[model samples]
Target: MPVADDIKSSWADEVELEGGALPPSTEVRENGFKIVTDYKYNEDEKKLKIVRTYKIEKRTVSKSIALRKTWKKFGESATDKPGPNPATTIASEDVYMQYVTSKEEDNKPEDESSIDKLKSLGDKSVVRCRTCGQEHWTTKCPWKDTVLIGGKLPDDKKGPAVTTGFTNAETGKPGGSKYVPPNMRDGAAKRTDSTNMARRDDTTAIRVSNLSESTTENDLEDLVKPFGPIQKLYLAKDKTTGACKGFAYIHFKFRNDAAKAIQALNGHGYDHLILNVDWSKPPTHSNQ
Candidate 1:
């Protein structure tokens, strides 16, 4: 059976598809190998998981190309004759953080003040948990599962109501039907080219925040320029307040710089809320 390489697919959409209809169960028992045939469907994916993994040892055991190669790679790395295990060391992690403010230790100007340095390298810092009343970071918070505001659950929180379908002004063909929650309207991206070409620096976007309440579009632009060559800075605000909505966007001249900012701020929050850093602008052709 031809299996799909849909490992990175979403929870609901990662269905395995077989190319064609399969022949009825046939036992192709060779000299020393036993062959088993079955068709099983993975309920969650609503797809098939035709084959499973197992090991068999015989007087003269032989494995398929894929398994042999995988075994060779695993065995080579697991050997203690030399180097460290690359697979064991490389893993991605998610983290939560908080930044606190304090009065400057030096007589430097407040605006140009630097963060106060810790007294010693191994100094014990006591942190209060956000969810629980524990004396440790949020990761170790015992009451992480407890209710915070005693209101609606975060998962139960609902926002603006949405229409299931809308009249299609363009084709009169149900101009907009909501098959998915985010529906493509979340972005102005082209599907055909998105799977192929990438967006250029001029089209990249940045998530800018912590901007002063009096910061105007012009001031936001000037602040972001020093980070790197800036393509654009988009500042959205409440129409009545005239105050910054605690968020702004900046497009960088290069994608790397934008990625750097995202890495620096995402999860590592400032003020409190973890910034939502993402590519807001869609990809274009000329800039690439």
Candidate 2:
């Protein structure tokens, strides 16, 4: 490998220079890196442009994640060129923000009169009583003393009279200032008679016995509903286990409907047990 003197001189004169100007110098620090941003404002167009430049040190990543990063874009991103697409990606704009401190009065306790005003406003709302059908609470109704039968008051009485068991020692008359139990009050017997009369008038109730433990009110309803319109259905269940207690009461709108249900389901087999259907008797109370 012998070279001529002219070739050696030409090679020594040829210096290797960079293609473009060197990039701007970056100040590297151990605590934190610096962010350099270039801002340009165009007065004619009323526009402000910003270009942020930052450096990030390369770190080791999992091989799977690196392979995923090298995968080709698919679906909606398949036609998109490299880097952020101007049509899809938007540059963030500066937003003005403010913080407000609450006033001392806002944290203070409300005035007593304000609370009373709220109570008065609430009272102004219509509140019809369920007992008397008046503009008052059911508990404060004037006719609350009267027994409610079928969501209605008895047509025969205005209200029950509350008696004070005060007796004159010589006259033997009931005019004492002592308190008397409601059951011992005067006219108590009349109230009981009215209640019993109401119950006796309902002759469409039927009793169903030998029901399965897993039976529910829905099951009984489904069984007897086809016979007629059901007014009420009561299934007796154990309080502890919440299971059927082998009996139930169903009140139909008409006696004929109840009779039909009894005829159909009396000997019917349900849950591997025979059903016993019969007319329900009004409950009786013993003096004891």
Candidate 3:
């Protein structure tokens, strides 16, 4: 059967209240009146469609529930971080450069301030701001860049000296680098700094505490030399008397080579005992 067109979101579900109105009041109650009940029916198809109809209404929630939801999704923004650490490499632009002119001539110009010599120069040299060093060219260096292990640290190196000795740049004292007189060489044929870059193959000097009374420097070198070059192999002796102190310093030409010796022969047979091997470096405060 055809019916009234629509329904709604929330139905009032109306019913006459059981106790509220005190029964049609005393004065009107004495009279009886005709009551009309509206009945709706199906004409042809025989089914009841609009049994009854009611309207719906809605209301807002109290304050407490709205506040509870505010806290769940946003406490603070996470898109931030602290600045870079001091130990980090810094990037920037401060550079200097120099060059040589007229190399075929016996005396190359000592200075590079003149542009007249720029075309005449045999080669160009770049002074890197990052490392504070000079190179024959700027091919590899970036103009402004984050510092790198590109050059030596000041503490790791010292001003070039006019002399040389065993006090070479490690442990007990100062370091040294090969240098040539400004008067002699055609170009700087960079001298290697034995102390600055401690290559993995650099020597690991060992001072064993309990070496056998019979173990000699030659004996230790004889064992390790097979694996790598044994540089300055010797056992430490008493300062005045000259008897073996039962300990030795076996310097390898390289650090990794020394490590290999410490690994392969550390627990090997040494006459009556095994060698006690350890790496010795000048002790720092924290290492203490």
Candidate 4:
């Protein structure tokens, strides 16, 4: 009995010296604690406590990537829900703004010149430079330190009409302009000089070919009236007989109308003859 009592006393002393025992690589601190190994245990009547601490590092995210993530989350939520959600709405707005900014960046010219910017404007777009109040590059601005000298080419001026007070010997008509020298004119121009000078072509006009000689201007008008308003109708006729020459030009008030008339009337049969309709070629000279 005495030996057993001595052994128990020695064991208690050993436990006190070792701080009531601890897990491997763990130490007993004088303060609250270092780490919590288990959820069990407590002091007094409370549940057992395990204290722990960690040195957590903060993470940084890029704006683009963060926006993308938020947008993705919002999309998922919207897909699951039937109606609108504030979170999804905000996300969509941000995403759309980012997309537009990206597109602007892509479309931006490398030089960023006002001239380049003005040239890039589409039919629907109009850009006015803030510096010059003109639709051109800012760097080329007159108000800037650098002056743009003659950025535009000189105007093409027709050297004053060569007025030669002469008359055609056979025609007995006063010719204010000298005839283009035979050697100087291109061969094509020389061959069709008279016809080219006498005839004119309108842009908003459709030429009808393969027409019956009996086809009159009135008849052509009736055929094209359904498409648009008629500006003028000229049915070629024989100067002597005053009979149609089997071809005519029909001008429309609008180019769109002319195009529509061509589409509807081309290859259409009129007066028992199939008509060929197409855009009239513009004349070379203003006189024509």
Candidate 5:
């Protein structure tokens, strides 16, 4: 038989050649290695451009997390394949919020019961002014400068009504809606002028002079406390240094006790100074 030149070749007749094909654009390497796939150079800009892709190696994860990943998805995600669905899972945008008072609600009429409840709650928390017994701080009381006798206001200065939100135990009626002074409260006793004047009397008070600068109120109290129950004791001291100003006033509950203290303590040696004890004289005002 003669050789046919136009016959097609089969795969069995083809022979393998060494180093025949060129390598791919991306170099093959182990996982976690960075591979450069494309690069370009710009001559006018004097810059080189290169693109790279990294294959991160598989990391060991906790058993709980790995198990959770294997849990079958449900709800809208039941038909979703493994991995997050771009349609259902998207990046969250930042949200901003602000506080704004509603003007429409300000004009709304409040229920009477709600108003009473609020007033009751406020009575528990609101400060009771000592000066006027009003629902305000003592410093903000309108009658702060007014004189009070036994912590009660005078009859003429009393307010029209009481708004303490307290119900009368016997009558079972709501207290009126006006501020009431503490003195005018139910069961409050009346104070007379004679009692107030008796408390202010200085007849039983004695003065001690020539005291040491280091004498304290306690030291002076100890010196004359044996005489009688001391009503009030005041030790005059320097405002800047806090040292005794060499004089003190001690008031006794009885004039006889004060007289005994004066007779015994006068010219007595104490704290390296002679104690000059005498009855405290009332201040004399020059006729203006």
Candidate 6:
């Protein structure tokens, strides 16, 4: 008969001292290992006792034990080998990171920039101004000068909203639903492109806070330009005062480059404030 691994069964066996015949019907079977037993009976007190014993052989190793064995082997190999080269160690890490990034890109969507289209469509397409019936945005409209408000241009009205999505017969997307008068659209695409580009590069964006009010866009650009190629730099400003809000964002072309910037630039001293740099969180859509 086939036996289960490490099966141990126990039963009582009676052997009478004064019996006419000890039980001959008792039987044992299946014999790779012998059944061992011990008996204890009073030599002359007429008392009896029975005992049973079995041997156990465990075949499974514990996880901790296996881990210790692996560590021992690794340590032995390290003790026998020479130390690794420092330059090779750094280069290997860089190569490994590139491999990992490429694998991740294969599994995910291609990274895209918000300003890619804007870069493609520089000043080739000119926008017209709506306020003065000329080609310009409301802020740059010449008619703002013509509008008389107490014999002066009104402080409240800047100009007509920059027109976008409007198609023209010449050098415009065909089959556009609506046509914006050349007088109505000025620098609309450029403005929209900048806004979208500001929010698009979450993977490469670094949030910098505690900026001095005097810090300018050019200053922020120069500060981080040493780290990597910058895709965009936007310094938050108060609309009313047109001054820096003590915070800014910088987007680098690569995540690795952004990480390097964060490591090297965080807590670094600027003009008047120590910069706090970190990865920018993705914008919340609901708030916008």
Model 3 lDDT tens row, 93-117: 8987777676766334444334336
Positional deviation of 141 in candidate 4, in angstroms?
40
Stretches off by above 4 angstroms in model 6 are: 1-200, 285-288
Tens digit of lDDT per residue, candidate 1, span 165-219?
2223123232233343332221212332354333444346776665446667876
RMSD of each: 28.8, 24.5, 30.2, 30.7, 27.7, 28.5
Residue pairs whose backbone atoms clash in candidate 4: 41-48, 41-49, 42-47, 42-48, 114-136, 114-137, 115-137
Residue 65 deviation, candidate 1, in Å? 99
lDDT of 4 by residue, 1-288 (tens): 888876756867876656544444333343543333334424553344454443333457899876765554354564643223435454333433333357667656654665465576663235554343566555545433321122221223111221122223224232333455542222223345445433433778888899998877777778789998898888999999988998888888888999998898888887787889999877556543
Ranking by lDDT: 5, 2, 6, 4, 1, 3
Candidate 5 C-alpha lDDT tens digits along 1-288 = 235555545455553222123234554355666556543336663334354545656668999998987899999889985545557777699887877889767654554445456567866555567655666667755545333323354545333332233333224222432444445443232333333454466889999999999999999999999999999999999999999999999999999999999999999999999999999986765221
Least accurate stretch of 10 residues (summed lDDT) in model 6? 146-155
Which residue pairs of candidate 1 clash? Answer: 168-175
Write down the lDDT that model 1 would get: 0.49
Model 2 misplacement above 4 A? 1-186, 286-288
lDDT of 1 at 49: 35
Query: How does residue 112 of candidate 6 score in lDDT?
Result: 30
Better of 1 and 2 by lDDT: 2
Candidate 3 versus truth, CA RMSD in Å, comes to 30.2
Q: Give per-residue CA lDDT, model 6, range 1-288, as digits (tens).
A: 346444443232223433423323222223433233323346674544343222334457999886764553354355432223233444333443344356766643332332344345776235544443344445655434332112122333323343223324233322333545433434233454556565566779999999999888988888899998998788999999989999988889998999999999899999967989999987677333
**What is the TM-score of candidate 4?**
0.31
Clashes of 1: 1
Return the TM-score for each candidate structure. 0.25, 0.37, 0.29, 0.31, 0.34, 0.31
Candidate 2 positional error at 235, Å: 0.8
Residue pairs clashing in model 6 are: 128-135, 128-136, 129-134, 129-135, 129-136, 129-183, 130-183
